[model samples]
Target: MPLSQSEVLAGLAEIVNDETGISADAVALEKSFVDDLDIDSISMMTIVVNAEDKFGVKIPDEEVKNLITVGDAVNFIVGAQG
Candidate 1:
């Protein structure tokens, strides 16, 4: 079965936690990496790399920076897979 958007977002939260040492639960759909998570550019890059590895797809930098929410990441992954 295909993963749901929430599931993908949850997985992304886990990946983000693994990379940034933050709590996965803290990442919400409305949360911004800069304002909410206080994530730096390097950590964001790590997120992009980890996400690519996790989803087996390359996320372009433009898309990476635009991922402001869990739903955004989920949508991106779904689109990439499609």
Candidate 2:
């Protein structure tokens, strides 16, 4: 079954929190990973890898660059699951 946006968001929040030590509550659809979350590129890659494993979705490096906001990542993961 494909994950819903909120499901993916919650999962991604956990992954982000695990990687960056940021509060999962801080993660929201409008937040930018870099500007809002202050996630550097290295941490972003780690989060991406973990998200792939947790969500069973493949996020290409090219696509990773395009995932600017939290919602973007969640939407990508949801779409990729299909």
Candidate 3:
């Protein structure tokens, strides 16, 4: 079955928390990765790589530039799944 947006977000929360030690609750849809989660460029790439593995999606290198927020990542993965 295809993943839902909520599922993608929930999984992303775990990935963010695991990588950055931030609270999963802090990874909301509107939260900015750098501002809210304090995710640096390296960590952002890590999240993308890990998300790709977990969700079976390929987040292109160029497109990774656009994933500024948690919602953006979720939307990308959900769209890729379709």
Candidate 4:
């Protein structure tokens, strides 16, 4: 079965909180990874790697570029897993 949006969001939030000191409560769909979260390129790549392992989905380098917001990542994981 495909993962729900909440599952994806929660999983991503955990990864973010683990990798960064940011609180999980601050992670929302509308938040931007770079602007809102202050995630640099290296951190973004780390999140992607961890997300792949957690979600069991392949996030290509090309697709990663399009994932500007938390919602974008959640939607991508949902669609890819589906």
Point to the candidate with the largest TM-score.
2
List model 4 lDDT by residue over 1-82, tens digit each.
8889998999999999999989998989999999999999999999999999999999999999999999999999999994
Q: Which stretches of candidate 3 lie over 4 Å from their true place?
A: none
Candidate 4, number of clashes:
0
Looking at candidate 1, what is the lDDT of residue 60? 92
TM-score for candidate 4, residues paired by index: 0.96
lDDT of 2 by residue, 1-82 (tens): 8878999999999999888899999999999999999999999999999999999889999999999999999999999995
What are the lDDT figures for the candidates, one per model? 0.82, 0.94, 0.91, 0.94
lDDT of 4 at 16: 96
* Clash pairs (backbone) in predicted model 1: none
Candidates 1 and 2, the one with greater lDDT: 2
Q: After superposing candidate 2 on the true structure, give the runs of residues whose Cα lies further than 4 Å from its correct spot.
A: none
For candidate 3, the 10 contiguous residues with the lowest summed lDDT are 31-40
Candidate 2's displacement at residue 74, Å, is 0.4
Ranking by TM-score: 2, 4, 3, 1
Lowest summed lDDT over 10 consecutive residues: which window, candidate 1?
Answer: 1-10
Candidate 1: lDDT of 6?
82
Better of 3 and 4 by lDDT: 4
Candidate 2 contains a number of clashing pairs equal to: 0
Cα deviation in Å at residue 77, candidate 4? 0.3
